[model samples]
Target: MTSGIPDSIMALVVKQDGYNPNPEGGIHFETMEPYLEFKEIAVPDLAAGQVLVGMAMAPINPSDLHFLKGEYGQPRRAGKPAGFEGVGTVIAAGEDPYAQSLIGTRVSFAATPDGTGTWATHAVAEAMLCIPQPDSVGDHDAAGFIVNPLTAAAMFEEAKAAGSPGIVLTAGASQVSKFIVALARDSGLDSICIVRRDVHNQVLTDLGATVILNQTEDDFAAELTSTMKERKPRFFIDAVADATSTQVFNAMGKDSTWMIYGSLSPETPPLPNTGELIFRNKVIKGFWLSPWLSGAALDEKLAVFAEVQARFSDGRWSTEVGATVKLDSAVETLVEALADPRGKVFIQP
Candidate 1:
């Protein structure tokens, strides 16, 4: 047994055996929590170069929903705990010197690539991937620090590096998009925020968005094309890949790149437009955090993480937490608690 650690860890695990995500294959949020079983299991043992995180909080993100539906990049085990990222203190560490150094530190962690989930009392993560949490950031902010904020930073940097005049964002109401909107404004670049509803307009506008377009409005197409002409936003940070993304991509002038980071929609983007590919020089690509972080330098990752912490620390950027669902009742209460998408639902012990 390890010091300051218990043998059994209680977690909300998914039973993936019989649940079908339906014939259409989109994640049904309501059915997801019912498939989860909250129970006790032995704490995962750490190997060399790993640390044991006594987790504090984790969020239920769109990615987590996709994973529960067995549609995420990683494979899911039948009884495996369900979560991706969380903040916790290192209660135990394996023999590696770097790992041992993290023994008493609080850190934010993503689940290991080997499919170890983070929704647990304790998680075994590689010491290298456990980012030290700054004292300025609280557990609520830190639990979600990695996923949305880091993606916002990386993708925004990509647009900046390309010298984009403005960035176009689909699903602008999302946490990542909100961060990007504030970033573009602070950088003195235009942020064209696209949303399905006009109700999200004020929140995004308050974040300094250059343009807000409601895809449901009748004038959306004209606004998109006109904005494309004026702002010349060639870089698209897309989260929802559907007909709307197609329309936005079509409106661009030339050398436009559609960077899809999430799949909130089930419809595949009808692509391979011979003209766009052969003539206009448009391209489409995917952004998965694991591969991106894995390929980045240690220094770059640390710099981005630190910068994100500073943003959350200040009032400039923040993720709203509507409620904190206790671990014991997470399975029963998570879905209802998360019904309002405006604020995030956090799970904790």
Candidate 2:
């Protein structure tokens, strides 16, 4: 156990009370008295190459919602604390090659195996799992930047690898979409950003998106088809998976790659047509950033931050648009944010 941090720490606990008639059943939230009252076990002792970090901030990402609802991925065996990515300050370190220099540093990173998530106040993790944050970056920005920025980078890399001229992003104006827009702009790559409403157009356009289309408008398909009439979009990344959006993908020329990464439509399940793949030579792929990033090289992961930080500092990428909430109000903030598409809910500790 560590010297000062104490055995128990204030944490969000989830338990499987019972099943419900509704789909989102079997999960519940409760704030215990305090850290010390729980099991009274020792604080997690640092192992060789391990470090103790006090989580500073973490976002309620879509996957986090799934984790909370016990829907996506394998359902947790039973009760478990949940979170995916976070920025934390190191308080102690174990014997390791990297420990000497990493102590007392704030880092932004992601971890797995459920218990090591970023949802709590303090976490003990391997030193390699922590990516040191620059002194220039604020804690809030550092926390919010980790996952979305990396996803945006990966998407761009995927598109470029396919020799695609431009990229198409569903769920435009989302925290991730905005990052994609900024990243694409900086790389001088053309992109079409799709939003569900006309109201979202100007916001994304002002953020440097050249082409913005409304998914609900009658002319939506025509607009997309006419714009890309000469050349079909080789890459389509959908964060919004609706039957209508899939229709758009179906209309694209053969030999195109459509990646489905999200399901913004609550009622519609993604149903891909087989003929497109068989006859049109099209491909439909799914992506989940967490599993893909597991076991990636440290240098490769750190590179994401270096690029994202550079863009953020230069005004090419932004983190200011999201709604910010203090740590104490975190649960309420998350509930409200999850109910609406207002913006990402950022919790500061």
Best by lDDT: 1
C-alpha lDDT values of all predictions: 0.84, 0.67
lDDT of 2 by residue, 167-226 (tens): 788887777888877767777776788877776677687777868888778888788887
User: lDDT, candidate 1, residue 98?
Assistant: 93
Q: State in Å the error of residue 49, model 2.
A: 2.0
Query: What TM-score, computed on C-alpha atoms, does each candidate reach?
Result: 0.93, 0.85
What is the per-residue lDDT of model 1 for residues 294-324, given as tens digits with 9 covering 90 to 100? 8988899889988898898886888877778
What is the TM-score of candidate 1? 0.93
**How accurate locally is residue 339 in candidate 2, as Cα lDDT from 0 to 100?**
49
Question: Which pairs, if any, clash in model 1?
Answer: none
